[model samples]
Target: MSSAVATVPGAEHAGVSLLRGDGVITSYTPSSSTVSEVDRLQSTYREGPCVTALWDQHTVVVDDLVAEADRWPRFAPEAAARGILSMLSFQLFTRDDSLGALNLYSSVRKRFDLDSQMLGGLFASQAALVLAGAQESVRLHRALATRDVIGQAKGILIERFGVDAETAFTMLVHSSQNTNLKLVDVARWLVQGRDRPVSS
Candidate 1:
């Protein structure tokens, strides 16, 4: 965001909008509190340059928010009142899904030009790639941790019940189903219990 504010012409503030796992769009890495408030307005109104860029178009450029009030009836007036006159947004995406948008805000009318768009687009693309890689790494790490805990649970079950690996796994599945809990939860419970010291 700091890089964007420094490099993008007329950009006073910058922010990343991301689609959360729960299907909500949220502001991330906002350059200032003003950017965060503007993003909140976008979420509340659901009609802004960032929303349009994320869902309908690859990019959105608003030269004058006051003049464009009709386009985004609820959001424009509110944003303009906050002293944000011009805005630029570029859709951020990966090969598999639409990630979110990169947004630039300016207090001057007609602040962003074609040059700004070009430079911001390049930055947005790089941001998308970095975000995608970070998300994938988190997923891989979570999967590995889950596997390790489940393996430990299986080992405990096999030793205590004098059963084979397959039987131990089946027992875990049955416990999960009977308790209406996630398989991982059941495995975690068993593993945690095994580590607790017995009462005298």
Candidate 2:
């Protein structure tokens, strides 16, 4: 974590935290107590930037807590509880799609400098690499599911169109290409009659 902050280059009095996959308060710099408290609140209430970051796998910022509206009502109270006036948080994401976050806070209202925010973002990037390992495990587990679904859809195509697996896959690919959609979308539609494949 110190190494990550050190590599950040421009942050002053930087505070960083690494969230657990479950959005728990895993660890952070001691000066980042508000962030730690917010993490605890998020874990306890299932709300705030930590939980939001995990869910959305993106950055979250509260520039000015006092002037800000009800963007995060529950988190607002939690911020008040922790004496936090401003914060910036980002999800530490893996390529395979699991999430965690790095949170930073300041006692002064809207006190964050742009460099600190970027530093926080950099922190998230490092944690994202760690998450990639977990995410790959998840991806491996889902490979079978993906293959099964595609395979089922391919079988449906073969039966319906009297084509071989290669031809069926080709047709699926052709349709996807023609309509600017993914092969999975075409396969999903083929498997389920009268259905449109919707992205999750």
Best by lDDT: 1
Kindly state the number of residue pairs that clash in model 2: 0
lDDT agreement with native, every candidate: 0.87, 0.62
TM-score for each candidate, following the candidate numbering: 0.88, 0.49
For model 2 the local lDDT of residue 112 reads 57
Best by TM-score: 1
For candidate 1, write residues 1-200 as lDDT tens digits: 89999989999999998756555668889999999999999887888999898878999999999998789999999999999999999998733433589999999999999999999999999988887788789889999999998899889888887889988888888877787888888888888785542111
**Which parts of model 1 are misplaced by more than 4 Å?**
94-98, 194-200
How many steric clashes between backbone atoms does each model show? Answer: 0, 0
